[model samples]
Target: MVKSNDSMKKNNILSKVLIGAAVIVGMIIFTIYQYNTAKAWSNRIYPGVKIENQDLSGKTKGEAKSIIEKKYKVGIIKKKLNIKTDARNYTLDFSKINPKYDIDGAINQAFNYGKDRNLLKKYQLIKLSSTKKFDLKLVYDDKPVNEFIDSIEKEVNKAPVDATLNISQGNIKVVPEKKGETLQKDKLKKELSSKINGEIDHDIDIKAPMQAVNAKITGDKISSINYKIGEFSTEYGSISSPERENNIVLATKSINGKILMPGDIFSFNDIVGERTAERGYEAAPIIVGDKVDSGLGGGICQVSSTLYNAVIRANIKSVERTHHSLPSHYVKLGMDATVDYGNLDYKFKNTLKYPIYIEGDASGGVVLFNVYSNNSLAGTVTELSSNVYQTVEPNIKYQDDATLPEGKTEVEKPFSTGYKVKVTKTTTQDGKLISRETITDDYYEPVEGIIKRGIKKPETTPVIPPAVPAATPPTPSAQPSTTPSAPKN
Candidate 1:
């Protein structure tokens, strides 16, 4: 019994020694593991840290920064992020926006992961970071994006078309208003900013940024322009005067298809532009100064004159008008409206309740202008007449011409009769004289006839007298001999 008891005590002591040794070995192992792990993270990033999906494990801060900067900058700047819609597609280029990478900041963040924690907590942090990845923060300026969106807005926006009177193919009508479209710039800007910042690694789809715009003049506003308010026709021989006809055609083309709203003033010179050769005008006879001369864009006055009479018949108010220096055969005296580009212009106002469209056409041997509106003045008869109070006959004038032969006479210019006349417009409505207004009080200057007479004389021929025969010289020697002989005798 005593031997057994001693053996049990020895076994117990050996077991204690083994237990202590095992405990020491375990502590040593744990210390080595902690030291190695701490050492591994002392100058390097955690094992599981990544920058833009690029592994930055076991790298120092500088090394991680180089890797992240080089890789991420190239990928971002060289990548084309497409922003697409059904209508258009655009590319977001990082290079153009001056993209920058915060490699140092990101690397410092990754390197210091779990660095501030205690040893136990740090170990736990490292273990967590090893399995789960952390993403780096990215930043960029949105100025370029905003600017791009503004440019798109400008490109997509358009003004609405207003409803108004229009004339086409010699027919007058009303054109309906059209709605316009514009890009929603603010909305698009916000969306783009969000998209680029949220998803920097992939392309995005953007909706078409458009908004409807209403027109200022709606169809209901101009719905009253529907009838013929005034019209007149003037006869003109097409073959006799082509330049005049061409001038009429061009002026009428410019004036045609024109719409005048209520209270709107119409200026002839402003619409027709300058009459020049570059504008397809040919030289034709025009009244310049006080006489007829060939000038560019002549015969346009005839159009103005015709339109003037039509406007008068329509009962519209004339703002400005001037009679020609000489009477026009196309229209009665004191009833014509003459216009020069810079000096004179024919103007009038709509004065009516509704808008008016001027439809002019020069066809066959007639020039016609029909003003269309909602009001009908077709039954009114307008008669324009000029009564001459005093007549002035031109006198004959003479000029010297050295190029013509003597006693030859030629007519340089024909005489034109002048008159002091009063123009009247009688408007008879339903066989009753509604108004008798004096249109104009004109005084035309008389033009004298110019007769060119030859005053130059021809050169006279000079007559030469016959040459006298030379006196005979042969008697000199005989005379000397005879005189000498006589002296000797």
Candidate 2:
């Protein structure tokens, strides 16, 4: 009985195993079907893709591929619109797994990339300033250009974009164009412009340098030469600033008869006109050959002295000039230039390549002089202090004009100034004394007159002894001895 039951159990176990096997086969078939279906759906959903632009809304992969395949039959070109900015190669990654990877979007992106790659330039959209040039002109007279020039330089440095642009064929960056570089016809057609705006802010002529010019006298002191104002020179001071007009004449002459060539130097004494009332000179105190006297436009030397400085600051060479005998009170010592008519004079030659314009003025008792040039000079000029030499003179005897008092009644002691000085000129070139000249300044010494108050003393006669006239000296004292009796009678 145990054997039979065991056999039945075995059969039942075998049957169960067979049923399990059949179920496993059925499951395998179902799995195969599902896998094939999924694969067919994947192929249908995303077919051969074509990319034209970046944006794709409803286009399917198969349709996009058809359109691309037909249109791209001629072999698609690798376009590089901006080689420098944008890369030349396509950026799509096929291995990239994205559920929303649209064929149309990819096609659009590829087209944009290719278009940029095909161009010769890496950048575009340049502004007007990059291609524009600003023209400039020198309208005003030559003067100090420090401030305005600096401003112009600053503007140039602050330029936003470089004027030159580099471009070439087939996505290659070419060499940038330069000012004188050879360019293609199309490149030349693309005009580059730069604009600069500026004006004559301040008139260069209006700014008078007022430098100290070296004055030297080549003539002798005792040769009977005199310092005199020369002919007057006229010039316009300013057009805008009429109040700042400078129409005053220089105190001396520097150029005469001969026309000054370019680069000629000028001297004050040589150009000074004869200073006389007849020449429309206002009477002004002047140093006359070592003497103090009144002369025409006596104050005009202030203009000469002022010009003397302007020339020095300009760094021009001084040909000749004569200084005052004694240091002048108007200008500092070692900074005075004196002019004499006919004989004593000051002169200087221009030593520059360009012509220099001199502007002089003497309005309202003030003299202003200026020099204008295009460039700064190479050499420099510095002025040394002037020394005063007082020579002791022999006391001059003069018949006192009783009318003049010995001294002013207000002051206790009379002023006694007795000295003479010849305006001496010490000329130097490259720091070596080239020449020495003496200009005489004859200052008259006032003679002190002896004065006594005119008054009458009380009438007191000189004491005279009373005379006794009784006997007229009794007949000769000699007879008194021999004729005693006669004397008694």
Q: Native-vs-model 2 lDDT?
A: 0.39
Candidate 1: give the clashing pairs.
none
Error of 2 at 452 (Å): 11
lDDT of 1 by residue, 1-489 (tens): 357978999999999999999999998888778767877677887777776677877888888877777777676676554655446777767677776666677777778877887776666655566643556555777788777776666666778987866665645456898998888777877776566533345555677578899986677766777667677877777433788778878988898867788999999999999999999998889998678899888888888998988888777868999999888878888878999999999999998877777778877767788877774555666777889999999998999999888999999997788899998888887789899988789999898899999988988999999999988865445434435444553
- Candidate with the greatest lDDT versus the true structure: 1
TM-score of every model versus the real structure: 0.59, 0.30
lDDT of 2 by residue, 85-171 (tens): 011221211112111223354454433331232111111111111221112221221122233333323332221221211212312
Off by over 4 Å in 1: 1-175, 180-223, 237-244, 274-285, 291-296, 375-380, 392-396, 410-417, 447-450, 456-489
Q: Please give the lDDT score at residue 248 for candidate 2.
A: 33
